[model samples]
Target: MKTLINITLLSFAMLFMSMLNAQDTVKKKNGEVLKVVVKEINDSQIKYYHFDDPNQVLFTLDRMTITEIKFAYGKEYKEEESIMTDDYFTEDQNMVLSLSMSSMLFDAIIISFDKAIDPKSGFQITGKLLGIGFGPSFENWYNRSGFDLEVGYKLKFSGLKKKKWEYRPNHLLSGRYIMPSVGFTTYSEDRSSSQIKKNLIHLGLKFGNLKIIQKLIIVDYYTGFAYFGGSKKRTLNSYGSDVDFEYNDINAGDLLGSGNFAVTFGFKVGLAFGQYGEQKEKLKRRK
Candidate 1:
């Protein structure tokens, strides 16, 4: 009787151990099976690992392309803030925020056109005009997106064996000073419509051609010039309206009216993001 009772207890223990091991093992539909050690399960994804690869793999909630991933952990977002304290934003979010702080919302009517004449000398012809200027504000000036056109050219004396396009690295220099003509003001008379000046500087790199046929290993980086200055603008007349151009003198910043011109100086840098077109693929083949 004692022996039988011991045997029954041993069997029960073995069964319980087997069940526990099974819980730890997860089988996928594919025959390429991977044992899983379940960690913490969340509403979004599952945390586990294969027997061979001990790395903690996180599966997405929707089962996206990635087969495994680590747990989605870290940070939160608030209503008023633009950048959040999340791992995903650690890379480029801060730079974008910094740009927002420096830029002021303003009314700007600018037209710029650039033409590329030589692919070897790394030269480009450019022309720009700004009329009916305004203020520079970023807080509520989202309606201000500018229009610019740029063309690049390169000239190589003996590159690509006399091929139409020669591939090499090049640079271009640019500079400007811009005065914002628009911002939050008490009255219309406090600011003028056109007496605004802006400053800008650009040191361009990677001015060579990236044509497919003449493709060489390509890598380049250009830094924006360190810029500093405040923005201000005042319009004397409403152009056609009966609005007066004089400040009430209560909240005006120093200058008021058209006759009273203020020297508002600002500096701007240029970093060309990309200058490619839809027909870019085809153009790469020849030059």
Candidate 2:
């Protein structure tokens, strides 16, 4: 009777041990399954220990290699973020404030402010402070400032997957886009005794890109051609009198291409400040 009791007790203990050994299964991309007890999951990998092992030694599996994890309770852990989704072309509605590096270096001091009217359209206005003539034009000149404004409609050509189109947001005004703009500029170059003035209208068509980092920092680069119209002249002569006309074999138009046509290239670096300004706030919260 005592031997029978011992056998029955031993059978119950073995059954309990088998139940305790059962755990979740990790499914790998290669179709292998690991019976594991997951400890933690993070952006990079999954940490777990073998369910049936006596020592229960911890192990790590690459998040990319994992297809999914299935638990005994029917819960699952799957990687949801894709590599393609992290690209700069992700759709966003952030206002961009940019400064032209080329204009700052060689031609003018240009500050541009832009805001999206929608996902596909935006407007930009630029304030420019012109530089003084360095060569034979004047002894001293000051105060050359004006504004240029334009509206753009964007067209994107990359990453068009018909299956994912409805799920993925459309980005017309971000990343690789075609940009067309029209603008007007007026500035006066004041010399010691006289002033030269300009009133110009511009039309441009360019390819452009706006890359966002951390969803707050922006880098803008574009290159295209601009057609300029209107005119420029010395309104007040060196003699301090309103001049009727000054004739030269080579006018300002001839030197600057009829004040009409030229190439346009810009590189801008700046910050996005509107709805996307929460990037900094989000980062702080994470810390």
Candidate 3:
């Protein structure tokens, strides 16, 4: 009876040890739960082995897809804690509507809409209405009638750290991006004695940073150059003498003339909507 009791005690101890070495639980963002032996976790991926497999073949998963992990040793890892260190985009919050703050100073109302085609790329369209804002009245130039249309394709760079802080992913559209754009401007400027109609086309490349504030406001600043062409020269007098009239400032020339190279820069403020905005609202409600 003493030997039998010793054997029973040893069996119970072995069973308890086995329970302590059970599999880890991995919960995915899609609500799938995985039973596995986690092997390694890096910045972008998680490596694991199936718990039921005797051979212990390895598998890999994107770290972003995982929401939580409960280890057998009573340790828990939550994905939310590391979200700010990574870059990701949700399907719902992928669009932005912005107004050009700099354009208003030029007596133009420039409104732009941006649509994200994917996490790394998107497109933008801007509509410009000239001579309608509370800008400086160009008294020398009257009857200013024209519109400008611009379209651009944006390519975003990932894995770049923010200058002000650590790798924090707060906004749906926050990063450094390069954009190639095409624009068309057509307008008639009526001077006191001479009226000139100008039509111009330009090809431009821009480098910009977009930042989101308070999960609702967007601030975008960009600087670039545009090659303007396809514009007729301004005839200064009724004699119809074509002269190359240019502005000393590059930005002014870029916005007002053609057949030359000009510098472009602007600031825009706007709103962010969709999935991220919805999430922000939900968090506010919870608070």
The residue ranges of model 1 lying beyond 4 angstroms of the native Cα positions read 24-35, 39-47, 51-85, 93-287
Backbone clash count for every predicted candidate, in the order shown: 39, 2, 2
Superpose all Cα atoms of candidate 1 onto the true structure and report the RMSD in Å to 1 decimal. 20.2
Q: What 10-residue stretch in candidate 2 is worst by lDDT?
A: 247-256
- Candidate 1 lDDT over residue span 1-287, tens digit each: 99999999999999887655443433332323345555654533446654345355554221211133322232221112112112211121110000111122233332212222222233333222121244543213222222222222434332212111211122211111111122222222222343222222222222222211112222221122111222234333445433233431211211112222322212222223222232233466878
Using lDDT as the yardstick, the better of models 1 and 2 is 2
Candidate 3 on 1-287: residue-level lDDT in tens?
A: 99999999999999997875689999987789999999999988889998888888999997767778999889999875453331354434667999888866666788889976655678999888876656664432566667888899999885343332333344557778999999987766767766566677788898999987776789999988888866545556566745455632212312542237777788999997777445545667999
- Per-model TM-score versus the true fold: 0.23, 0.51, 0.64
C-alpha lDDT score of every prediction, in listed order: 0.28, 0.61, 0.73
lDDT, residue 9, candidate 1 = 100
Candidates ranked by lDDT: 3, 2, 1
lDDT of 2 by residue, 14-72 (tens): 98887797699998767789889888888767899988777878999867676789886
Q: Quick one: RMSD of model 3?
A: 9.9
Query: RMSD to native for every prediction?
Result: 20.2, 9.0, 9.9
Best by TM-score: 3
